[model samples]
Target: MIALTCLCGQVRTELGKRPDFIHACNCTLCSKSGAHWGYFHPSEVCVEGDTKGYCRSDKEAPSAEIHFCEQCGSTTHFTLTADAVAKFGNVMMGVNMLLADERDLAGVEVRFPDGRAWPGAGEFTYVREARFIGEG
Candidate 1:
């Protein structure tokens, strides 16, 4: 299992298997928040802590919700909307790399999604190379 925790170790999560995909987003909130995206099946994961959800009605797509830790103001995970759940049971976990341990990211793939042009709602670039097996 891949374990994830907040900077202060107040919040914790266990990912049952390697993520289906990992991504780095350059969107306004993502870039400012400094989180590495890890996508997985929500049903295969377990979380423990005080987490809060935030949604941006103006820019959010049909299947995504941003989640953050209340105590440390750290973005922790993102859940897919109903549409996405029906299509792919993938939940995006916004892992705080700084807090992840080496064993927590074993066998994980990493990619980059060009959320930089989120303002213009342009196309996004997803990298196929690059993977993370340990804490960053």
Candidate 2:
């Protein structure tokens, strides 16, 4: 199992299996979140601790909920659409690299997704070097 946690260790999550996809997004909201995006099956994840949800309004006045840690203001996960849970049985978890070890990130793909447009998202820039851990 893969474990994800906040810097202060107040929040923690246990991933049952490896993520289907892992990458970074350049969208306005994501750029400010300060963590890598990891898509996983929700049923396969177990979350602990209190996380504050920030819902972003869309054109229809609906909102996408972004989950962040209240203690450190760290973005740890989010769901852009309600159908996401039904379709993928998964949610996006912002893997806290700071608290993870290098071996924990092995075999994971790191890409830069263009958040300018999502759903039919654009291509990503492949990361040649692994920077998830050992950075702060």
Candidate 3:
């Protein structure tokens, strides 16, 4: 398992397996938070410690509630909202892979999704070509 932790060690997330790929999105929320997201189901991992959850008020319907380490204010992960749960069910969650050591994720593909242009509809397009974590 791979463990990702917040700066103050107030939040810890365990990834049961290496993610196939991680997303570095260019949307407002992602860009501001500076998170590299690795998708997983709740059953696929474990989380410890208290976190403050924030749902964006700008969106008419926010899909996720982003969680951060209450003590250190480190962006930890995000959980789906009730409405999102109705749509995607409980099969999806996002872990902030940035909390993990980059060396621990070496060789994992990192995708740059053009979330800025994503109309909250269909598939995401690439902002740039994908690259592996340890690329020189």
Candidate 4:
């Protein structure tokens, strides 16, 4: 299992296993946060501690919900809204791999998603195969 925590360690999430895939998104919020995502099923994740949530929505894309440490303000994980959840199923969740332990990151591939110019404008791209821990 892999554990993801906030900078202050106030919030934590346990991933049942290494993610099937990891990717960096260039969407507005993602670009601002420089967040790289590791996808998992909600059943495969165990979240502990309290967190504050921020929900963002607009015309360009589906609304999203992000959860972060209440004290340190570090994003721990995110999920889709109700509409999106109905469409995609609540099995999917995205955890911030940037907060995971070093040993848990080995052999993980990092992909780049062209969410900046989403839809017809661009395509998903591969960024790298691995990341150095604490590089966040």
What's model 4's lDDT at 77? 87
User: In candidate 2, which residue ranges exceed 4 Å CA deviation?
Assistant: 58-63, 80-99, 117-136
In lDDT terms, which candidate is top? 3
Q: Per-residue lDDT for 1-136 in model 2, tens only?
A: 8888877777888877765546666666667767666766556667788999876564443235677789987676765556555555445434544344557777666666666566444555443443433244
Model 2 C-alpha RMSD to native: 4.3
The model with the greatest TM-score is 3
Clashing pairs in 2: 42-89, 42-90
lDDT of 3 by residue, 79-99 (tens): 999999998899889999999
Residue 19, candidate 2: Cα error in Å is 1.8
Show how many residue pairs clash in every candidate, following the order shown.
0, 2, 0, 0
Misplaced by over 4 Å in model 4 are: 60-63, 120-136
Rank order by TM-score, top first? 3, 4, 1, 2
List clashing residue pairs in candidate 1: none
Window of ten residues with lowest summed lDDT in model 2:
127-136
How far residue 1's Cα lies from its native spot in candidate 1, in Å, is: 0.9
Tens digits of per-residue lDDT, candidate 1, 25-126, equal: 667666776777765556776779988987667654655667778888778877776666777655444444444675655666666776765445566765
Candidate 1 local Cα displacement, residue 17, angstroms = 1.2
Name the lDDT of candidate 2: 0.63
Model 1 TM-score, all chains together:
0.70
Instruction: Judge candidate 1 at residue 52 and give its lDDT.
Output: 90
